[model samples]
Target: GSFVLKAAHDAYVPAGQALGIDRDVFSKILDEKIAGHPNIEIVAEEVVSLDQVPRPTIVATGPLTSEPLAKSMAEHFGGDFLYFFDAIAPVIDADSIDMEKVWRADRWGKGTSDYINCPMEKELYYKFIDEVNGARKVEPKDFEKDTPFFEGCMPIEEIVRRGPETARFGCMSPKGLPYPETDKWPYAVVQLRQDNKAGTAYNIVGFQTKMAYGEQTRVFKMIPGLENAEFLKLGSIHRNLYINSPQKLRRDLSSRADEWLFFAGQITGVEGYFESTCTGLMVSMFLDAKLSGDEKPEFARETAFGSLLYAITEEEKENFQPTNINFGLFPPLTTDLDGKPFKGRDKKLKKQLICLRARLRARKVASYQN
Candidate 1:
């Protein structure tokens, strides 16, 4: 295909705006964006050793980092874990959900009715569990067999292996949410959170799996509301390598051992296209400031940029894992704009408040260089 410019939007994207770029199109646009820029060269070569890379450099080699470079990084940083297998959850067409079989509500009566609940009776939930346990899983690659799965992205089937009731206590728990159209809680439930601003798609929260795609399509459709569900993206598993940024990188995402060295993208342990791009953009800004002798500005924690940076740079050092930019990363709100304490029900206003605060702060994260 010839070079084409196209725009797309995704819920996972901060601010819900993105450009859908394929490889050829990406090359064309990158050339255009950096046209006539000084002191930049696009070198097409195999980066076998980090030692050979120039100073003031960034390593944004992404998930499928080359073996040699990964080796160099491990040896240089004295850190382990060349890789881990991660599973992604499926995204469903929101319109396909049988609204009659599912009801919208916030679990535990917290926040707005931000999740679509698929209620299942005891018989159905048990049957679904049996099917899930019996479904054919994707066989691991030779390299993936020894690699551990990230705890945060643990596949649902793997959880089931611990016990049939494990899921009942985990993601499929119905402890707080009552059954659809009734006060009595269902035996188990499936929750779908809005995955896009348009509400066109819903992600099956915490449903990452290693089930074969065909088995996934057949088994997942057994849930009450998703009988005719259209999967926008099917769950998948892959090997990924990311650094422990909180312990390894600095506030500006530069190396602690080498001020001139920087890291970005998935290598920094962020798990989305938007997060990776933000890491690169932010790193460039910080690197430019350091090299040019200007103070680097920081994003407010209220903003997605800051929240993501906070995740990679300042999150709990123990049991670190990659994650998409999410509202969970945002700081909790305690009061309304009037500075009064919020009522119990006002917790529903929390997301809107966070967005409002982020928008206000994002205006001041300037990018233009002197």
Candidate 2:
């Protein structure tokens, strides 16, 4: 709480969009704070096993947890406790998206019209699939060779490999979302979901891939709205470690097997830097509460903190993937402060109201004292 984050406006996105920071500098700042802390230790030794760890421990062994400890963790946690790989989807600059080719709508018009769908005809979609089938993939390294791919975050290339039309049944499906101009269903579709509150970025939903960076740019540009797209991040797969918190851990992030054992960071199923950092901060509070018998701060359900916590701990138990704190995770806000329905589909104003609600409620969660 005492440290100041150094951030700069990200120029790649639309003006007043997301901020960027040098993560290396941020890590150095954290190191300085930890070094100055009286109770902390700067040990270089690696932990070999969970058995060796004392009770009331906060196990935050990151994505690349050492082999021996990983095994010990699996043995203790039981029931396919940890996942090994992270298939991350690519993000695009919103300003670069061609609004003409893509239309915003909820699937079947059943929910909020937040998704931007890019429709592709049968012939064109198959031709694009041909390119994806042949594109060069980034082969997994020796150490990552045995890592099993989870079905939930399957790579786009892997889908294409199953069959030419296999993708139509999965993420590329046009089942409910109608095609623009024709008012009929598209043969296939590529959906883009908003990645940040500012609406400056959208991610290629279910496009987590292992294609080479150059290949990703060349191949994905085949999509209708992305012909001249500016990619903020390319799809890639890496070895990551995250447990299914909804099934494995409690509300306070303590392991079900032992109340005193806590976990945090990416390993706790939160994605991105700030989400991980906040989880680490919250776990310390939970641990202190356990020791002193004090009530833990319960983050309000409407706040970003609570939305993220709900994602990891209360979302459907099946197909739990690590996630970033996003507006999509927030509880839906249909009416404004005056209880008036959103007369116009003004997304900016809707998001602003959610933010305002979070700000007002976050005080209670931040008020906890040890």
Candidate 3:
């Protein structure tokens, strides 16, 4: 069934802030792009189930999939796929971090101290927890009320509701690392992890929240190193639906139970609009290769897109969850092509070297393809 485009009057908010679409603009763009395509048709109808569509179908139903279709998918895949309340953490511009108030360190000084740690004194920790508990949060819609939240992805407000000390014991734990200069652990700590290859942004690790956007800014800025932070993106939570891609989908994104059937987008366990778009592109490329009897393209594992595809198609199926593209998903770069050791170097420098190498590898792969 073809969905009608409804233009949203509000500005285009990036995906993960919510599943919002500027429907009117989006629809118009799609219509224009497909204007000259003869085989593409936009029909207005509701698709109730997989049975309604013919074989060799590509499903991109997205996060808000219809109930009947979701049920049909569950039956076809066998066993109930897990449901989770996913949350997005606020991203901060790198230059906005108060570097003097924060220290670079990883727990137990592991792996080049890649994280930025913000220490909070006892009083400050309690105050922060109180503010979080009292902050206004977005209310889940009726349909989303009953969905179970994955333990790993619990909202910060809900964690605070559990108990005042829950945050201290969990993500904010200062168990292994001592506050720099003072030589002692702080009452609590907040960690920020690099979000992009350029090191221009960092996300508050484990700070995924349901707090209203305004409140998120106010509360998060209270962290020691973020007082003057500029948020690139704010925290939010939503009900996300996805299949067990590792178990259900082949490397090419075709269903294991039926090779002709394929899936893409968030439904395939990758998160965000960009990730989903990449999956669609990959699926189309794979289909083209198969139909033309061309050699299957091999994506280099070091590249971001290659890493995301690996995450969805090859990662261990047990405890699998939807993931956004991140360096953690990429294969580690422990040595250079010449076999030189990459350990014991500065964290940021190491990342730079890895990124450079990945880009070179990607270029080489593209050249080979051409």
Candidate 4:
């Protein structure tokens, strides 16, 4: 008989929403949900190694994975197991963005006018930098203090601490992006990228930080277009460890060295709460199908879930990195069913069509499975 084992404190709450809910309330809800399932066994102990467990185990420890298990996994994988201090940027409610102050345009008019750019005057930019530099930051735990942060994903405060000119030169640069009406560039620009399919949320591009939740809300609102911004999720930083999944795991997310072992969630290089949850679901489906001697079901490639799985399992091996669900991971739909070219059409309309097609295909797959 198979059983589920999880550490008592090993909950699946996202770091971005950690400060939003009371810990006791969150834990109680989680415990209640898990208790409804008969197979789950919450072990009030640590999982130090895979060797102590039975075969056919699935590891989904997420970004803040335990040190002992992480060490054991690294030894099992053998290649350069990557570690990075991941900083999550704050997500804002789309309705709260002040459209009058900001304009939508892609840099250099290269792609669709998708990004919301908030221009800042020279004085305002300087003031913003000063505030960010002085904001209270979350202190790392003792174990995480020594781990180095990846340069590409450094916290906003850490970037500001580098130099006053760093932000303007890097993420906040005004070059190649002129205001739509004025046709002039401001001293600095803060860009927000669409975060969901419905355009209900946007994330501050390159503004990932370790700032205290209150401080993040306060300082970010100082930006021109976000004076009354409503935060959907706040910025956070955590020590993330993941295997090179493309090189280490099979397409089914099973270990190449041992078919009995499986990997999922952040440990297998998929990021975000939604993506991790999808992986867990997919792995379960695969395992169930395999044990029952049935053919593995395939997810539609056009769907977000399938695209994320493809990126982690089938992307190039040399520079394998953890990825969140995004349109870039999805396959491009260049033509319609009638073989009509989709080029030179309105980008928003094209995206809508793509999403519609994906949804329809996914429904067909689901119906077939039923």
lDDT of each: 0.80, 0.81, 0.81, 0.80
Pairs with backbone N, CA or C atoms under 3 Å apart (clashes), candidate 3: 6-24, 7-24
Any idea what lDDT model 1 has?
Answer: 0.80
Model 3, span 266-355: residue lDDT tens: 889887666877888788778878878898777888887789999998888668888888778878778866779777558787778778
TM-score pick, better of 1 and 2: 1
Q: Assess candidate 2 and give its lDDT.
A: 0.81
Clashes of each: 0, 0, 2, 0
Candidate 4 local lDDT, residue 277: 69
- From the highest lDDT down, the ranking of the candidates is 3, 2, 1, 4
- The residue-level lDDT of candidate 4 at 20 comes to 22
Q: What tens digits encode model 1's per-residue C-alpha lDDT throughout 308-331?
A: 999998887567778888889998
Candidate 4 lDDT, 1-370, residue by residue in tens:
1112132123322213121222344456567768877988877778888787788788877777787887887777775567768898999999999999998877777666778899999999999999999999999888678666766678899898999989999899998789777789899999888765456778898999999999999999999989999999998987788888888888789888878788888888887655776888789888888889898878878887788888998888665667777667878878875679877568787777778878988888889778
Tell me how far the alpha carbon of residue 221 in candidate 4 is from the true structure, in angstroms, after superposition. Answer: 10
TM-score against truth, every candidate: 0.67, 0.63, 0.63, 0.66
Query: Judged by lDDT against the true structure, how good is candidate 3?
Result: 0.81
Summarize candidate 2's per-residue lDDT along 1-370 as a digit string, tens digits: 4243322122122212234343444556667777898999888888888878789899998877877887887877886655566688898999999998889887777556778899999899999999999999999888678776766678989889999989999999999888656679989999887766467788898899999999999989999999999999888887887887898889899988878789999889887767887788788878887798887778888999888888888887566777888889999897776778756578888899999989977875676542
Write down the worst ten-residue block by lDDT for model 4: 1-10
- Score residue 273 of candidate 1 by CA lDDT: 66
What is the Cα-based TM-score of model 1? 0.67
